[model samples]
Target: MLNVLSVLIGLFALLFMIPAFLPFLGIANWLLVPVALFGALIGMLSTRNSGRNFCLLVAAFGALRLFLGGGIF
Candidate 1:
């Protein structure tokens, strides 16, 4: 259940990046980083390595987007 939730959160976080590219949407897109981090935390708590790895990848992608989008330094 937790694993499933983590995966869902990671996927959602990945999807959230789409809004960052839109000129109309601004800082609101940065909220996805925290969501990705939450998924990473959940994955870290999981016993399965795959879950942890997927979450880490998602988090990294989110962070990269945030940095490139100028949401973070």
Candidate 2:
């Protein structure tokens, strides 16, 4: 159940970051970072894993955005 939720949150983050593909949506794609991080934290607290998979997923998503050159930094 918790694992499922974590995956869902990760997926949603991926979706939210997709807006970067639209020209007018420039800068807006940055917002997905926080939204995804929030979801990841929620999923992390709800999960029973020893390792922080949620945090890792969030990092990966952020990195993906960064690698795509869509980061605010």
**How much does candidate 2 score in TM-score?**
0.52
lDDT by residue for model 2 over 1-73, one digit each (tens)? Answer: 6556666766676676566545555455466666666666666776464223654565566666565664543
Model 2, residue 27: what's the lDDT? Answer: 55
RMSD of each: 2.6, 4.0
Task: Kindly provide the TM-score of model 1 when superposed on the true structure, using C-alpha atoms.
Answer: 0.71
Angstrom error of the Cα, residue 59, model 1: value is 2.4
- What would you estimate as the lDDT of candidate 2? 0.59
In the range 1-73, model 1's lDDT, one tens digit per residue, is 6778788887887677667656545365468767877887887787765655676786676566556767743
